[model samples]
Target: MELTFLGTGAGRPSRLRNVTSAALKLPAPSLSVWLFDAGEGTQHRLLQTPIKLNRIDRIFITHLHGDHVFGLPGLLSTRAYDGGVGPVTIYGPAGLQQMVECLFQLSGTYIGYDIQYVEAVEGVIFDDGNYRVEAAALEHRIPCFGYRVIESPRPGRLDAGKLKEAGVPFGPLYGKLKAGEDITLPDGREIKSSDVTGACIPGRIVTILGDTKPCANAVRLAEHADLLVHEATFAAGLEEKAELYGHSTTVQAAEAAKRAGARKLVMTHFSSRYELEDAVQLVDEARAIFPQTEAAFDGAVFDIPCQC
Candidate 1:
C-alpha cells in the first residue's frame, strides 16, 4: 500500500502547493486506488502521474468545503469518459449526493457508470473480506469525519517442514491442513494445523482525518495506526488562529499522534503562506513531540512498509 499526496496546501491553492487531496493505492489486497479527498485540480494532478481515473474505485469526501470537494463532478465525469465501467462508491457527509446530482443535472451531463453514495456517520461504513473502514465524527467547523482503514489479518505461513514431519504428504490435503483443518494421515492419525502453523500476521492500519482541530475523536481513530495522516494548517505558534479556523497547528497534530501511539505521522494541509523551504521547521516542530513525523507536499508518495 502507498499514499500519493495530490495536493497538500490549506484553504486555497498556491504556487508551492495545491489544496487537500490524496490517493491511497492498494496493489495487493486490492487492485485499485481510493481517494481521500478530491480537492480542486486533483484530476489534473492525477493526469501528471500514471494513476488512471478509471482505476479509482472509491472517493471519500471529508467535508463539503470547496477546497475538499470542488473537483468531484469533474473527476466523476472524467472517470466515465476514461472508461470506468464498474460502480464507483462515494462516502461523505450529507448533501454529497445532492451536490453531485445538481452539478450533473444542471450541466445536462450523463455518466456511463453507476455512482453509489454513502452518507458517512460515526461508525463502520464499509466492510469486505479484505478490509474494514470505520468513521468517526471530528471537530471541524462543519460535520466532518475521520476514517480508519484496517486490513484483515492474514493466516500464518504454511509450515511445510512441520507438515512433512507429521507424515502429511505433499498433496491436496496440504491445502486443508494450512487452512486450520484437521486431517487424517494414511496411518489413521489425526493432525491438527495448530501443531504446524505459526501465529497469524497482523494487517496494516491507516488513519486519515479530515480538516479538524485537536479532538479526542482524532486520537481514538488514530490509535496505534501504522500511519496517521493529519492536518497541520499552521505553524506551532499559530495555535490560536488555527483553533479559531477549525484547524490544527504542527505541535497539536504531533501531540495527537503521540497520544494515539501512532507509528508514523504524515502531516499535510499546510497553509499556503509557508513555503516548501519551511517544511523542515514544521517537521522539526512535529518531531519534537513525535519523532516519526514527516511533512508531505504535492506529489509526495509514502509506501507503507509491511508490518509482518
Candidate 2:
C-alpha cells in the first residue's frame, strides 16, 4: 500500500500546502484507491499524482468542515467528465449526504457515476474480504471521526520448485496445500503446507484521525497500527491554544502514537505559520517523544511494506 498526502495544511490552503486530503493506493485484491478527507482543490492535486481519478472508488470524509469536504462535488463532477463509470462510495458523518446533494443541486453539476453514502458510526463501517474499516469518534470541534483500516493477512507463496521435486503435479493439490491442508501424493507420502511454504505475511493497519485532540478512542483506533496519521495543528508550548481550538500539539500527537504502540507516526494538518523551513523544529519536537516520526507535507508519499 502507498499513501500520498495531497494536502497537509490546516484550516486553509497556503502556497506550500493545500488543505487536508490523502490517498491510499491498493495494488492487490483490488486495484482501486481510497481517499481520505477531500479538502478544497483536491481534484487539482489528484492531477499531480500518477493515480487515475477513475481508480478512486471510495472517499472517507473525516468531518463536514469546509476545508475537509468542499472539494467533493467538484471531484465527483470531474470524475464523470473524465469518464469514470465506477460508483464512488462516500463514507462520512451525518449531514454529509445532505451537504453533497446541496452542492450538486446548487451548482447544477451532474455526475454520471453513481454515488453511495455510508454514515459513520462508532464501529466497523465497512468490511470486505480484503479489508476491514473501523471508525471511532475523536475530540474535535464538530462531529469528527477517525478511521482505522486493517488489511487482511495474506498467505505465503507456495514453493513450486519443492512441490515439483516432491513429484507432485501442478494441480488441485497445490490449492489444498496453500490452504494448510495435508495431502497424500501418488506415492502415499503425506505433505503439509508448513513443510513447503514460508511464514504468512502479516497485514497492515493504518489509523488516520481528523483535526482532533488526543483522546482515548483515538488511541484505541490507533492501537498497534503500522502508521498513525495524527494532526499536529500547532507547535509545542502552545498547549493552551491547541486545546482551545480542539487541536493537538506536536508532543500530544507524539504521545498518542507512543501510547498506541504504533510503529511509525506521521504528523499532518500543520498550521500555515510553519513553512518548510520550520519543519526541523516540528520534527524535532515530535521525535523527542516518538523517534519514528515523519513530518508530512504536500506530495509526501509513504510506502507500507508487506512483512512476513
Best TM-score among the predictions, by candidate number: 1
Q: Stretches of candidate 2 above 4 Å error? A: 160-162, 171-195
Alpha-carbon RMSD, each predicted model = 1.8, 2.0
Please provide, for model 2 over 1-308, each residue's C-alpha lDDT reduced to its tens digit, 9 standing for 90 to 100. 98999999999999999999999998765988999999999999998999888999999999998889998888888899877479999999999999989878998988887899999999999999789999999998899999999998776789988888787788899999887788998889998888877788788999999989879998999999999999999999999999899999999999999999999999999999998889889989999999999999989999987776
lDDT for each residue of candidate 1 in 1-308, tens digit (9 for 90 to 100): 89999999988999889899999998663778999998899999998778988779888998999999998899998888866378899999999999999999999999998899999999999998788999999998999999999988776777888987888888888888766688898889999877878777788899999999999999999999999999999999999999899999999999999999999999999998899999999999999999999999999999887676
Instruction: Provide the overall lDDT of each model, using Cα atoms, as 2-decimal numbers.
Output: 0.91, 0.92
For model 1, what is the error of residue 216's alpha carbon versus the real structure, in angstroms, after optimal superposition? Answer: 0.5
Scanning candidate 1 in windows of ten residues, the lowest lDDT window is 78-87
Which TM-score value belongs to model 1? 0.94
